[model samples]
Target chain A: MSTPSSEQEVHEHGVTEAVISYPQFLWKALGVATDGNALFYVWMTALTAVWLVGINAFAHQIVQGQGLTAMTDHVSWGMYIGNFTFAVGLAAGAVMMVIPAYLYHDEDMHDVVIVGEILAIAAVAVALAFVNVDIGRIDRLWHIIPFIGRFNFPVSMLTWDIIVLPGYFLINLHVVGYLLYMRFLGRKPNPKWYIPVVLLSIVWAVSIHTVTAFLYSGLGGRPFWNSAILAPRFVVSAFVSGPAFIVLALQIVRRFSDFYVGHKPIVTLINILRITAVVNLFLVGAEVFTEFYTGGSHVAAAEYLYFGLHGKNALVPWIWTAVVCNVVAAGIFLTVDPRKNLWIIDVACVMTLFGLWVEKGLGLIVPGFVPSTLHEVVEYLPNALEWKISLGIWALGLIIFTLGLKIAVAVFTGTMHVDAAHDAGEV
Target chain B: MSDPSRRTMLKGAGATLGAAAFARAVAPITEWTNDLSVEGFLQKHYKELTVEDMSAVLARIERETEEQYGAKVSVEDVRPTPGVQFAYALNLSVCIGCRRCAKACHEENNHDRATNNSYIRVLEMTNGSLNLEHGTVTYDHAVPAPGKFYMPVQCHQCDNAPCVRVCPVEATWKESDGIVVVDYDWCIGCRYCEAACPYHARRFNWSKPEIPADEINPDQAYLSNRIRPQGVMEKCTFCLHRTRRGKLPACLEACPTGARVFGNLADPDSEIRWVLENKRVFVLKEDLGTQPRFFYFFDE
Candidate 1:
C-alpha cells in the first residue's frame, strides 16, 4: 500500500500513457469475446455461473460452522488445508517465469513470463481465500497483527507465514508491474528493477513452499512428513507441477484459439516443460532411493504413501500412478514422436499436468496427515460438497485467468488483425 | 530492526508495569529473603532479558493473575526444604501402568477437561530390552493389559536444552532456576524448537483452545499456563507458576506411589537430594547430552 501511484503498463507492456486502463480494457475485451470466437471464453463464462451457485450452497453450510463439513476429529485439516497447500505450490510457480526470463536471461520468453508472476498473485489470493473459508474464524485473520488481540508470533510458524507470504505477494506485485510497464512502453525494463527482484524471488519461491513444508515437518510425530528431505521435495514438486500446469493451460488455449499459430512457439514451451519435468523426475527418483534405503520407521511412511504400509494408505496406487505418469511424460517429451506432433505435445501436456497435479495437490498433504498423531487411522474422503466447493473455486481461478488473459492478449498483441481466423494457413 | 512487533512492545510494557507495582507491594516481605536471587528478578524476552532482568521479573510474582486470567487464583512460592536438592525421580520399578501423574498434570495446569491433554506420559515399556526406543507414549488404551511396564515421561526440564538452542526467534528458553518456560505470545510457532527437542515434549494448538468457563484455571500466568492460541507452540513449564512461588507441582502431589519428587537442586538437604544420595537415580537419554531434571530409579 505504501508503494507509489500505479503506473499503467509503462512500455510495450502497456505504454498508452493516457492509454486504455486495464479494467476498462478487460471489459472491452470481454465484450469482444461475447461477440468473438474464443471458446475458452464460453467455458470461462459457464464455469463462473456454476461456481456462484455452488458457493451459495456451501456458504450456508460453512457459515453454520465447520460442523457443516464431514470433518470429524480425525481429518482436522482435510480438503481445506489440502487446497490451501495446492494453491500455495502453484503460486510458487511464478518463479518458472521469473527465473528463466530474468535470472537466466532468456529474452525470447520475456513476452509470456510476467503472466506467471500475475498467476502467482492470483494463486496466493485464492490460497488465502480458501484457508479463510476453511478456518470458519475468517474474521480473526487480523489476530495475526501484533498487539491486536494477541498475535503470538514467537510460538507459531503459521504466524511467521503471515509475514512471509504477504511480503512475497508485494515483491511479486512490484516485479510484475515494472515488467508489464516495460512491455507497454517498448522500452528496456530497468535491469536494476528486475535483476535483484529475480534473485529475491528465487529465494522467496523456495521459502513459500519450504515454509509450507516446514508447517508439516515441524510436527515431530507425523512420520510421513518427518523426513529431512521434505523441503527440497516440496521445491521439486512445485517447479514440476507449476510448469506442467502451464503446458496444460497453453494447450487448452491453443485447441480452441489461434494463439500458437506456429509449432515453434508451442514447441519452445514444451521443451521448457520437458526439461523441468525430467529434472523433477530425477529428483523424485532420488527421493524413492533415500526413503526406502533408510529401511526403518520412514519405510512405513513411504509404504503408506506408495505401496500401502500395513494396508492403511489406499491412496498409494494413486500416488504411484502419479509417479508413473510423470516418468512417462518425461519419456514421451524426450522421444522424437511428441516433438513431431503438436497433437501429441498437447496430449503429453494434458497427461503430465494431471500427473503432477495429483502428485502435488493430493500427494503432498493426505499422506502426512493420515493416522492422526496418536497413530489412529482416520479416513479422509472428499464428499460431494467438498468437491463442489473446490470445483467452484477452481472455476473461479479459470474465470479470473480467462478474463486476465483476454485482457492480456488484447493488450499484448494489440490490433494485429492478421486474418482473425488465426492460423488458417499455418501448421 | 530495532522495532519489535507492537504486540511484543505492549506485552513488554504490561510486564514492566506489573513488575514495578509488585516490588512496591511486597517490598517488606521480600526484604530479608536470600532466595531473593535473580531467580526472583524481572523476566527477559528469551533474547534480550538478562539474568538480572529475570531477578527483577521474579520479584513481582505475587499473583496479579486476576488481571490476567480473570480469576482469583492463589499464587504461592514453593521451595525445597533447606539443603535438600529437588530432582524428579520416578521409580520405573514401581510405576504401575496407571496414568495418575498425567491426569494430575492436566488438572494442575488447568487444561481443558474435554481434551484432557497432559504434560506427562506414562510410557508402557517392555522389560529386559532396556530400549524405550520402540515404546509408544500415545496409547489411549487401558493400561497394564499385557507384557508392559509403565514408565512415565514428561518434560525433563533439561540442563542442556535443545529446544532453547534452535529457536531462531527466542520464544523458548531455560530459566536460571533450572526450569524451562516459553513466552507464549512471542513464540513464532516455527516449531524449530519442537523438532529440535528429542523428547517430543512440545505441542501446538491448531485451533483456539476451548476450556469450559467453569473449568478454566482462574489463576493464569501469561508465559506459563495461559491457554495458547491456534498456532503457537506450547509445552510443560515445570509448573513454574507454582515452583516460583514455593509450591509443589500438581503431578508431584498426585503421583499415588510417591514416584515424583520436586525440590530445589540448590538445596542439598531436600528429599530429592536424599533420593539422589541413597538411590540409583538415572536420567533418560544422557547420551544425547540433554541433562534432564527428571530422573528414574528403582526402590528394592
Candidate 2:
C-alpha cells in the first residue's frame, strides 16, 4: 500500500521502497475481500449462492448415488471427468506465459504473468474438486494417501496423475505466494526464491497435461484415445485455450481494475494462439486421417464420433461445431492483426476458448466410450443435474480467482495505503 | 465502516442460516453412517487384516445384510488352494444365445434386479463374420437363430489385468489362483476398472442394488459375490464360492446345451485343457496381450 506521485515515480522507487511491512501486507490482502463496492459484493454473493446450490445437489447425488448422473455401464465417466481434463489443461497453460517472462526476459510480460499464475491456482483447485465429486465415496478419499491406503504407484496412470496434479499445484502456490509476498513487502524477490522453483514449474506444467493425455492413451481398450499423437495434441490445444483465456481475463481486468496491462502482452498472447491453433488443428487432422484412412478395427470409434453409429449420433453436432470454431478461429488469428483491430482478436479469443471447451472437454472424452468394449454403441450426454454441479464448481473457482486478483490489484496499484501507525508496529 | 451494529446483526443472521443449511446438507451423511457398522467403518485393507479381523468383519457384514436385506446370508473369506489355477472354456458351436449364463450370473452374483445387471454379455454375431461390431446383445428371439452365433464374454481373469494395474487404490488384484477379485469395502468406486476392461466386464452400482430378500443369493463370499455397496464395482468372480468348493459354476450347471466348461488349468486331464489342446480355441482380443484364462472354442 505504497503509492508514488505518478506512474513514472513508481518506476523511480525501483519496486523495493519500504512503504509497507510484512504484517500490514497480510492485513491489506485480507481486507481486499471486505470492499464496500456494491458490484464486488453482488458478484461474491452470486458465486456463494451458486456454490451453495451445487453443494446441495452434490449431497443429493451422494445420498441417492451416481444414478442421478447420465452415466451408465456403457459410459462409466461423464461431464465431471471431462471438466477435470479441461481444468488440467487450463492450469498447465500458465507455463506458456511463465516461460517467456522468466526465460526469455520479455520485459512487458514480467509484471502481468502473475495473472496467469493466479488463474492456474484457481483452475487446479477446480480440477481437484471435480475429481473429488466424481469419485463414488468422498468419505473414503483417504485411500489415495500413501501408507494409509495402499497406493498403486509406478503402475497406475491414475496414481501418476494424482501425484503430479497436486505437485504442480503446490509448486505454483509456493512460487506465486513468495513473489507476491515479497512484492507486498517492497522487497526485490531473490532469484533463489523462484528460479529453481519456476524452472521446476515449467517442466511440471508440461508433465500435467502430458500425464492427463497418458490417462487416456495408455488405455489399450479404448482405441479412440490410444493414439501416440494424443500427448502433443493435448499440449498444443492447451497452449491455444490457456492463452486465449488469459487474453480475455486481461481484458476483464483492464475494465475493472486500475492496474495497467500493456497491449504488448495481449499481442504476444494472440501470436501464441495463432501458431498453436494451427498446430492443434494439424494434430487433429492427423488423428482423423489415420483413423479414417487406415480403416481398421479402430475406425469404429472415429466413425461413431463423426457419423452415427447404429443411429446413436448425440455427439455428431457437437464435434462438428467444435471443428468449425477451431478452424475459423485459427484462420482469423493467422490472418488478422490483433494489434490494430482488437475486436477481431476478441472474437478469435472467444471462439478459441469455446471451441477448445467443446473439443477437449466433451469431444475428447465421450467418443472413447460410445463404441464401448464389446462393440455396443451407447450415447452419453450430461444431464441437467451434472450441469448444475459443474457450474457450481466453476463458480467456486471464479470466486477464488476474483478475490485473489482483487488483492493483487490492490497491492500492485498501491490503492490500499499503509498507515504510519502500522509502520510503528502498533496493533 | 458505517452502522457497525446493523452490520454485526446481519452477519449473525447469516451465520445462523448458514449453520442450519449446513446441517440440512449433512443429514444424509448421518443416514449413511447409521447404515454402516462401526466395525465395518474401521476395517483395514483386506490383505492387511488378520484372520481374526477378517472373521469379525465377515460377521459384521452378515449381521448388516440381515438387517438391511432381511436375508440370513453366510459371508466367508474363501481362500484359494495351492496348485489350483482356475480356467473357463465356452463352446461357441454349442452356445445357443439362450443367455441362461447371463441370468445365472445375475442371480449368483447378487446383481441389481432393477437393471438386471449381469457380468456376462452374451453377444449374438452373424454366422459368417467374427466382427464384434455387428453383435447384438438385446435380441429377444429364440436361441440359436438362423445365420447367427453366440459369444459370451465375461471377466477374462487375465494374468496381465489392466483393471488391476489401473486401480489407484489396490482394491482389486489378481489372486494366486488366477481369479481377479475386488474388495467391495475397500474400493472407492472410481470406476477406472470399468473403463480399463476390454470386455466391458465390470458393473458399477449406480444406486443401492435392490435385490428382493427371497431372491438374494444367501451363499456369499467376502471377496466374491456379496451384496455390494451402492458406490463400488463388482464383476464375475467365476462363482468362487461354488468353484473353490469343488462344484461347477451356476451358469455351467444351468446351461441346457452344456456350452460352458470349468476346470483347473494346472491339471493336465481337466476338460478345459482338453478343449485348449484339441479345439480351434482363442481368447477375445488376444492381440492386446491380456493372457486371459477364459477361452472360446468351436467343436468340429
Top lDDT: which candidate number?
2
Best by TM-score: 2
lDDT of 1 by residue, A276-352 (tens): 77877777777778878887655555666787644676677778788778877777777745445756666666677
Candidate 2 Cα deviation (angstroms), residue A303: 1.4
lDDT of 1 at B234: 76
- Deviation of model 2 at A100, angstroms: 1.2
By summed lDDT, which 10 consecutive residues of candidate 1 chain B come out lowest?
A: B34-43
Compared with the true structure, all predictions reach lDDT values of 0.62, 0.87
Query: What lDDT would candidate 2 get against the real structure?
Result: 0.87
